[model samples]
Target: MSKKCSFLYGTLAVVLGIATSGSMVGSVYATDYSGSETIDLSADITDGIIIKSGANITLNLNGHTISTTESEDTIYVENGATLTISGDGEITNIAGKANIFNNGTVTINGGKITHAGSYYAILNHGEMIIEDATVTSTSEGNSMVVNGYYNYTSTDERIGYVEGKGIANPTMTINGGTFTGDIKNCIYKGDDGSINNISGGTFSGAAACVLQNVNEMTISGGDFTNNNSGYPVINNQYYDDEIDKGVVTIEGGNFTSADENSPLFENGDNSTIEISGGSYSLEPDEEFIVDGIGFNQQDNNRWEIDAPEEPETLPTVTEEQNPATADDILTTAGILATLMLGLLAIIGALGFNKRRA
Candidate 1:
């Protein structure tokens, strides 16, 4: 063989070897890591990992399990960066801290994410998404506490047990997967203003799904169960700005608020709560006013609950049957008399009715 041909064949063999060597192994890559890093996993990892900042990283796991023993956060993302986890992987943490915290964007396309966090299981500052994954949270068994400190003073609020200091009004959207947690406040959009939208998923939060001030909470389509103890599913209150009233809207979803109050509560008139679709049933004592829109559900599993643009009208049907009037009675008597006279004329012709009255 020629020397050039031999060299090409050797290069091809090297490439193929890397691809097939660790095909069934779990791995981690820190493509955007600029700071120092350390990784201690519960399972064996096949390939070495890198840490960089401002770069895209893909952490692939080959059916391996990674658990966090201590209270420290498992996955931490700083600066402006992106972290994507792929493959049949599982991340489990047994504390109140989240397995992943992204100051930028964190996407979990496929994996099993489990947490027993004392606080929030996963906190995102910028944007966070879970697609085609199973996220489960066990009982942290912590008491519900809601106290924020100001000038070394603490006041008790029924704040979310999971989320302590509310999030910075970040835009949080979930499209797919199962998320279960025993959280006081699953997502808190601090006083900075936030937008929360859930299109598709099976989300079950032990406490309120959202606790924020001056934020917009919108649920379109999903299997959501907010079985909290004290507050409603979406509760927003006590803000510095009068413009911080909360807006809770349920456009479409399979949602159930088991408590006596509503699954959603808008305290002042400034706070607006609208429900448009999915199965809705409040407690007997609680009433849902129709000041907003009606429930409209589609077969395709997509729904939206929003304020109507125009007013609605009642349906008109045909009138029902009633008793006969006075005019009908007079007309019937006259007809009977006419028939008698015709019969009498025929009898007179035959010499039968000769007496005249």
Candidate 2:
């Protein structure tokens, strides 16, 4: 062959080899899970994972990482499907819509999810259970949003209410994890019929640590802190309508506010908050008072109210009113000490009498 032809042929051969290798690498990294199956990540993936099948799917991270810059979600769970994450791994969304956009059930046992830009770390329109995980959002938006959809239409006669038309109401349960969203709410529930339960976690935010418009939330244990001045650590947006009422029960948690004047909780018009136990602290200010729409201190560690100025028909049960007397405790301790000393004296006398005999 001529010199020029030989050079062209060599270049073509090299191009073909590169193309073949690229295809092989793509095939090795790409993963599309469907049906009821479990997949373990063997290597770091660039392309996002999509779940189209309406079946239960399990993705084991296996200490790998999935990083993507695509506009789509890093992990998308379609409606009528379920996705469970197991093992330790990290999901990095550079500019995606969401790190995990769950329209179905998504359970995270162990993982690290980080999202940047305007999207949420987890936009849940279905059910989400974070047993153990770390979720962080650098965006100004919320870190986790449990949303419900409703449409209202007015007719000549009356207004019609349609439920479950757009996005289904979500139910989120956080047993143990760490959620950090410094700009907006760490967790937000937008509509009614949604349930949020946080048994254990650390939720920090610049605004409200948790905001619920019209929903029910039960917080047993967690550290909720609001770093900026906007709403309280837990805010229930006020609504005068009876149907738009929200309910919150703080069984146990540490709630703090950066601003001294800010209330640890802001109960809405018809909303109610029942605080059983939690450590709460605010900046020392004698003028500052704990006030809300319906605020009542039922006990030293409990507060309950339905709305402002509502009559307290129920009996007031306060720790101070019916407390254990210090004298009672001291008397019991003294009795126990006297019984022990009497026994010791009897034993000494028996030994002395036996030696003399």
Candidate 3:
């Protein structure tokens, strides 16, 4: 079916599904679109959309909202599926689970995933690339919960989740986004992968970023503000095993905390956190500081790079005050010439007197 017909049917389904209030009754539309498909929502949708199989779906909000009042995800992508969300629209879940639940590849280019059920705004189990988006929750929950893999061998298996364990990591590259929530950790990175790069984003929460069983992570740029007074800006939890230990490289960013004396970073045991760059409101752990980089306090509770010292200058000397000046040499030469001429005239006068005698 065409996109125009899909929108008409979607809106009609929502309208006809309920008689009293505008709500969806039973199971919403589940899309198993093969190959590639783009669905543009002309009106707001009060249902959930699931991308099944190996299909690739691009759902454009088109300046509209796709939300559901039921306890379900606004958009769900099954394993092996690919979903690319675009437009300046909103994907919200009211009194429900995460706004966008992904078990496959999901790339959010531009949009907002806001949920209210104190759950993750975006629960990512597979590869996720958030270039630009606003993933936030009003209640107390992590904004973006990234999972890798863990042992969930049970009837209710929650993949990529195991209390405080994450082994096989997921691949997530967050180039740009606006992630905020009133939770302990804004971005819960339980998936410890070797290639997780968070280049740019705006994060604000109790602890702006958290890392557990991290293999390797490089955060080159971002704006992180920790609102909670007790927590640090970046908290890397400890893992006991030697093989599971990993490194965290912080190249550049703006890290600050609301509390003046609170530490900006907490490097738990067994993790090597090398902070070579960034601006902080409080001091970081001395162990994480890299060599050659000066850490100076710019202002109250502000620490950044320290500038080098200036060179010293000497006083200027005048020619008149100097002993070996050109004027003194000329005066001595004139005196010597006058004295020599007088001596020659005296010798000539004596010789003339002797000749007369």
Per-model C-alpha lDDT, please? 0.51, 0.63, 0.67
Better of 1 and 3 by lDDT: 3
Q: Mind giving the per-residue lDDT tens digits that candidate 2 earns over 214-240?
A: 666788888777777656777675343
Q: Which stretches of model 1 miss by more than 4 angstroms? A: 1-52, 139-169, 182-192, 205-214, 227-231, 238-245, 259-269, 283-292, 295-357
The C-alpha TM-scores of every prediction are: 0.56, 0.63, 0.70
Worst 10 residues of 3 by lDDT: 18-27
Q: For model 1, where is the 10-residue window of minimal lDDT?
A: 143-152
Per-residue lDDT tens digits of candidate 1, residues 181-289? 6655553333334456668887666555534445566777787566764555555553434324466666667755656555455355446666656554442112343
lDDT of 3: 0.67
Clashing pairs in 3: none
Leading candidate by lDDT: 3
Q: What TM-score does candidate 3 get on C-alpha atoms?
A: 0.70
The sequence of per-residue lDDT tens digits that candidate 3 reaches over residues 143-202 is 355555333332232453333222234567888988776555555564433246788988
User: Evaluated with TM-score, which candidate comes out highest?
Assistant: 3
